[model samples]
Target: MVENALGDANSVFSSKRAALRVLVNHGEKDGLTAARMILTGIPLDETYLQNRLSIPMNDEKKSLKGGRIHIPDSYYLMGTADPTGILKSDEVCIILSFWYMHQ
Candidate 1:
């Protein structure tokens, strides 16, 4: 019984770990999370590598007084405090997008 329990636990752990790995590598976004980021002053930089914006807190240590999104494709950076910074506007509002296509 003990051995069987251990095996089951291991199996569950492995699956969870695998899922995490995929999420980390590919990047996953939720609308709510993205909205929070925007509200917190973190702009969305979608034009990242592999259409995936994995912003691992560029300025993690710093409490975000304000943040900007650097969209490499348009070469325009958007700041929440300063909406005028955006050269092009996206249809989605404050989208925390995981997948960004690179042309």
Candidate 2:
């Protein structure tokens, strides 16, 4: 199993169900540094990853394709966004939160 420079714990890069992850370089954290790995659950090295960055997903069923099990809109009881620009990487970690849709 390959280790993460910052990838997921169970990401082995060889799993049949492994999904894609896009690590976008962002701001810093605790003076160490931080990046946003958009998609999650896949362990790929720099060389392997760099070659496929931003390769947009073109699947119809996002949940099935992206390792994200769909949450019915009816299940979305309520939510809140601070909107104060106070969220940080540590303060909030997005493990496959957003997804892109095309028409």
Candidate 3:
């Protein structure tokens, strides 16, 4: 009985360690993807932003600040010269700002 209990505990610990490793690997991959997107001046999709970055979009629970002329329902960033851009600036700066601030 003691041997069986020890084996079960070892199995559970190994399983949890493997799961943590997978999560860490995924996080590294996602970080690389975000960096590439920023460097290439590509706009991030809503799914990636919300799901991976954990930025809420179009949430009714959040209240908007008063006296704002233009209120965006979702966050956005685009390169300069794009008139329709929400956050108009270089992609690297915008993405880095979000990444650091979110942490």
The model with the greatest TM-score is 3
Task: Give the alpha carbon lDDT tens digit for every residue of 1-103 in model 3.
Answer: 3343323223322343322222333346664554454346544443553243221111111212222122223354565454556544643344446575464
Q: After superposition, how far is residue 99 of candidate 2 from its true place, in Å?
A: 14
Global lDDT for candidate 3? 0.36
Steric clashes per prediction = 1, 0, 0
TM-score of 1: 0.17
Q: Estimate each model's TM-score.
A: 0.17, 0.19, 0.21
Residue by residue across 77-99, what tens digits does model 1's lDDT show?
35464356654455333544445
The TM-score, computed over Cα atoms with residue i paired to residue i, of candidate 2 is 0.19
Cα lDDT tens digits, model 2, 2-27, are 22312322332332123232122111
Model number with the top lDDT:
3
TM-score, cand. 3 vs. native: 0.21
**Off by more than 4 A, model 2:** 1-9, 20-43, 46-74, 79-103
